[model samples]
Target: MVQLGSRAGAPGRHVVLCAEQISKSFAGVRALHNVDFDLRHGEVHALMGENGAGKSTLMKILAGVHTSYDGSIQVEGQAASFSGVRDAEEAGIAIIHQELNLVPELSVAANIFLGREPLIGGVLIDRRSMIRAAERLLARLGVTIPPETRISGLRVGEQQLVEIAKALSLNARILIMDEPTSALSSSECDTLFKIVRQLASEGVAIIYTSHRIEEVLELADRVTVLRDGRRVVTAPIGELSRGAIISAMVGREITANESGKTAQDGAVVLSVRNLTLDTLGPHGWRRTLHGVSFELRRGEILGIGGLLGSGRTEILESIFGVSRGWRDGNIAIDGAPVDINSPADAYRLGVALVSEDRKERGLHLGASICDNVALPSIGVLSRFGLRSFASERALAADMVKRLSVRCSGIGQDVAALSGGNQQKVVIGKWLGTEPRILLLDEPTRGIDIGAKQEIYRLIFDLAAQGLGIIVVTSEMPELLLLSDRILVMCEGRQTGILARENATQEQVMRLAAPGMAAWSQVSAS
Candidate 1:
């Protein structure tokens, strides 16, 4: 049994909210058991757990999304029962979900004040007042997005900031943020941390949930870890180490191991020379990639590392024939030049891409696991121009078993699974195509530590089987861990490539930094 730490060093702050004996179930599945949690005024309490460990369920209950849960909630020493989100808002509570909940077609100001808009004469909406209020909230967060800009026009990090601004607009006493920084850059994360500190200082109690342990350690005053739907431990941040937190979250020690056999001398599988892509943005055709060149050897992992909008993802998109831009490059697969104009052409040439945004671009959320996994192989599985259910089921079952996807069999809807499992389903769908080269973009984003380790092992295993892989990731540790060689990018240009043994975080960052003349010369393997 792990000894829990006492909440010390803070004496005057009283409990602002509490949940006693909270338990929830969904479709005969026990999502959470009897769990006790509380938040103090001016505290950043972090909730940590693996995927499907009941963290989201608990947060939803507190946010009034799930009103059927068995629990007793107290707000400032008064028993409170919230029937809906409006009731929770009336109680001065607001929650930002892990998934962005804003409408894409709506403007930034419209999304910020979605349901509750300012009215002129208590009848018509005052667009000017709403925009002004939205601007103030964005200004408080140090964001400069225009109030009238459509949500679809913003990047993922910007969208996340908009979500934060939306939560702040409620002026709630209690705020819950679920995986808020999953899509943010380092600088964006720093800005968010400053805002979180400021909010806590203003006596706003916050319940923060994230899979990033370092962020939790830096920002959280106390941590409550849940495992298998039960509270594992609640301890002050000062009393716990990284190892302790991992152990509490996964019930074991996590060991770091090499991904797979280092195959530096292997045969070249794919080669790109002077790759350039130009996309038609709001400002007309803009160059996104310029003179990017690299070679991927069979059984080697090449990592693309850069800051946001640095053309890291664009490289993968171009190679996989999915870039919505004009491409100018020399691509050779197995020493033969090839032209890939569409995803089908890329697939025919033994190439597969797992997109960064799995929910939006990778998987069909409304479909079942079998349907999603079998989608990429429908042509192969069809007989006499008709779909074969037996073949699809067999393929789905095999992939599910190989990937260790936890679900109610392959018939379960993809939306019902946890983040880690949904990612597996996406990978499985691409693997069903039997591609020789795999391109992964931010594959472990929003997933827990345990799931990330599993993905790392899988990537290594695939590489060991002589499959070439190109991975684009924002995580420094993941880039260092999985890449045999790291390709650093800056402003759509290739900075340099560092060998695995020689690549350090500092070296990668130096090359990744824009306008760094010292390492501007690109190096190829």
Candidate 2:
């Protein structure tokens, strides 16, 4: 439905962008190696690789997100040095990252034209001109959202489209889309694909990257697969098979059930009855959750599934004693009623939580892994009034080795680590507390496939060791693969809890949409 660009034919088929001898490293660990890439105008070239394959690193270098990498990029047959993101934009290059980048407090139009706003009389910002420009832009993108709508109010799919509109506004000849479909629904993805093809037809050279192999195969004119930071294969999409691309990704064949299933018949370890929460507004308070209840058993992986704003996160935060609106709830652990009013109470009761935002809530970015892993259990690791540095180091080293975190050393800062390794450090730090129950919220959200498998295996191992675990995820394949039982939530209420053997995507989706249907039923695993 979107009109991306002028329908004029390309001047001619030619290579518009090229990179030579691209290499990047973080703290002595090589992330890329001599990766040569070139993009032809009017082509959709997909960059494929497993997590840690340097696909993102390579794209970052091209987009001027990382200017320190060892590489030489040529734009339009001329050697160009991009000093920063603005430089790349000036050179007709724009990128839409996997994580939607929009200021939540600003209006949609303000975000679309963030830096280069039209000014009147060389003085005040032209708000009226900005809205007109934004309206025209959104209409071209086939989106109906108002120009004045706050970004925070828009859904994920809508935000993604706004990002696309922003890039299109730049009029970039070379556009890079990184994992653009990750947050989109099926219909949203179809819309995105249609726009991508339209743009390509108008002579826009596109660099498309995604973890979904089928998507790459369908949309990409050429495919380039990277492994261990090196280019393994680059060829026309017709010349590559799905299995071949996958095998090149990980150097092995992987099955749908990567970690396999657990017995899932252990004793009930956590029981919740009639939990409720309310958001305090200026006038008073507004209710969110309505008497939600469920049970989690040891040696079992329970999944929470729902659409955005379904209160799936509220369930985890409330259970971990971090929710401000835990109005009434009865939580019993090991057949005894427990009161967890704070995170300390949850920790003391052998419960651990890995929040959705690992960077903000889980890890201290400036601190070393050694300090981070020992943070929660400092009291247990200490002797007398003074904390023992030696014990902390030993514990940190043990956790590093146990989790197989890819880092230069345990003394390295967590902020420098990759997305996957940062998550591992978060998991290791939490596991150091030796929790009997673990609650993970969107654990693999921004991570790669390989890292996801590692997390899945770790969860299975923990469950096998009699640790009860609850995972909340929006990824349907992940929920189907890991959950021994699935609980669907809608508008902060329990819609249904389904046994693993009988649970299906259609049923879960139905329950996820509020008032879509009468909940089939709910039963404990």
Quick one: best TM-score, which candidate? Answer: 1
| True lDDT of residue 450, candidate 2 | 74
**If scored against the real structure, what TM-score would every candidate get?**
0.94, 0.85
lDDT of 2 by residue, 235-325 (tens): 8887889888888888998665454365456788999999888966334687767788888888888999887667778888888888865
Instruction: Extract clashing residue pairs from model 2.
Output: none
Please give the CA lDDT of all the candidate structures: 0.90, 0.84
Write down the worst ten-residue block by lDDT for model 2: 3-12
What TM-score, to 2 decimals, does candidate 1 have?
Answer: 0.94
Tell me how far candidate 2 lies from the true structure as C-alpha RMSD in angstroms.
4.0
- lDDT score, residue 35, model 2? 94
Kindly report which residue stretches of model 1 are placed more than 4 angstroms away from their true locations once superposed.
1-12, 517-519
Distance from true location, Cα of 194 in model 1, Å: 1.5
User: How far does residue 130 in candidate 2 sit from its true spot (Å)?
Assistant: 3.9
